[model samples]
Target: MFNIDLFPQALKSDENGQTRSCLLQQTTMGESVTEQELWFAYPMNLPMPEDDDCDSYLLATLLPAMQLRAAIRVHGSVSHELLANLTELQYVWSKWLPERYFLIDIQVDRIRDQDLQVESAIAAFSGGVDAQFTAYRHATGRAGYATRDIKAGVFVHGFDIPLDDTEGFNSAVEIATQVLSDINVDLLPVKTNVRALWSIDWEEYHAAAIASVLCGLKRYAGIGLIGSGDSYDVLLTPWGSHPITDPLLSCGNFRIIHDGAGFRRSEKLIILSSWSIGIRNLRVCWAGNKHDKNCGHCEKCVRTRLNLLLAGVDNPACFDTPIDSSLFRFMVLKSDAVRIDWSLIRQEIIETGRGLEWLPYIEKVLKRKSSPKLSGLFPFGSKRRMWVKKMLMRNK
Candidate 1:
């Protein structure tokens, strides 16, 4: 059983004299792990959900991780509607990963009208391709929504960056602030140790974790836009954030919008290429640190650089170094989605008749050559299989 304890909001002033309210959650599970506390400090002047409204907040925030441990052992109570939503989410999880699924038993009391006041829409901003595209579209009213209604961008520290890496968090804040400021949107930096508290897969638990943050701000936002990592055609299974699961995370007050399912990563890059903000501040490095712009050598960095080149927006200023063709010799293309993206990028290069110098290298990278197996009739049997998969991808 897991328990959630909501502490009263505490207003405290930082060294800079800026005041902020600290929203706290203490979660205790039976036997498996020790009690963990999560703190979210928001600007004190901003209107937020009151202590009475914490039931829904806890439901969204604590339930996913708690369900993984034991049944939800609520310290106080939860709403029936949220319980139902969570139960459904658990079902979805079970379908996604049957090995990880378990029945969710809740300690709750039925409550009515637990929804907070509806207000503006906000998108998760991470200075990445998907997030930047979402922010750009929504902020410019291109998403078929009111531009001004989409207000601020939310950046959480613990999701992408390590919780203890204060320097990295500060760096991310700087980039996110600059990116959102260009679109005339406010940037809300949320600090949490939720990842540290629970032993959950980042890919599986991310959507729920992000939904929790947005739900906590129910008094402030009505629609929470989560940037989609995959396109509709190639939605990756076992992914935490998806078009299907993201919308289901919505409750009476908050609606989690999975933005940018229509556009592929390359397409999103093309859209962002025209935007000066994206050109200058686009960050897509998995191996980046507080000190570097982008390592420019990691798989993600290399791919982004290639995409930018294909989009005609490749700039040396945005990346620490030029695309090293040598990296492709050993760089492994692990997932089908990644391989697909690379194939699209290769096609773009061919169609445009540009970047022909890199074609041989790209082909070499895409052609997966596996090692020989002892039981195989043919030498390089796995390599033959890999060749078949590569041919299928090319034909498709």
Candidate 2:
């Protein structure tokens, strides 16, 4: 059996900021690896609470435990509500992806009760389309009663921007800070090494990692808003973050809400088009270049440009160069979900009678066939095969 031991360490103050860490020791199949640390660092002025619980560590390590079929035993306090919610969360995951993931056992020494105090919410902000939509609606009271009072927008350094990319992270943070500040929300920069700890699939592990970060910052906010990538009409199953599973990550006083799934990417962009601050400062590229925030050549950058153009914005300030219509010829959408996004863009262009010049390129993207290997593997159609196709498309 796999064993996971959680040991909370004292807060360390360094030149960068205050770091709260937990030492994770994993042992499996008669082999062990120690010295792995899961930590979150905040600015000097942001003081973290003294809550000595392993909830964050448990959430962060859940995917690894399931992969190893490990029974997790925490040496520190964990919330009873979180443990109970995890049962349902695992049920959803195992049900969706039976081949890759299954339910695992979890245990803890002390179970803490919920905090009765109420506090404002915090959102995971990457300066992307979804995140900006969520932040803008709530800040402008467009969400009405369902709106959350977001105290701060959390910009995680290690998620999109790598831990070693200190300069890139700081630069991106500056842009995110400015955009959030325009909506009257403060920016909280956080750093973590959870992704480096394991070789798990990032598509399945990212939400858990984000939840762990939010849980660790429960001292500052009670509610966490994870922006949704797809709307209800085009929901993608077996995804890391979804409207169904995001709420299950909540524990006791901390709540996770998946926001902005009601509108499509193009629809959301249309609304955000009016928000000048968000439009100018959007940073959605994952090209790994330190200097360029949005490389117009990448698939994501090209997609965002198309979305912006459909929304009636041309040559957005966030992108240095305009998207080339011919770029669609070489682009292969990695997933059916992304293909659907492009299809929706095409439909929007047709319906609005705008951006008609780019329809042929969008059609080229839509007409492209699936990988030959995938077609060969799933020649005999079945429910299981269809699900497998969807899952494989994500990784392809």
Q: Which has the greatest TM-score?
A: 2
Candidate 1 stretches greater than 4 Å from native: 1-33, 55-69, 77-81, 114-116, 145-148, 334-337, 347-354, 369-396
Which regions of candidate 2 deviate over 4 angstroms? Answer: 31-35, 369-396
Lowest lDDT 10-mer window, candidate 2? Answer: 373-382
**Lowest summed lDDT window (length 10), candidate 1:** 373-382
How close to the true structure is residue 327 of candidate 2, measured as C-alpha lDDT? 63
Candidate 1 per-residue C-alpha lDDT over 309-332 given as tens digits, one digit per residue, 9 for 90 to 100: 877775546775567677687767
Evaluate all candidate structures by whole-model CA lDDT and list the values in order: 0.67, 0.81
- TM-score of each model, in listed order: 0.80, 0.90
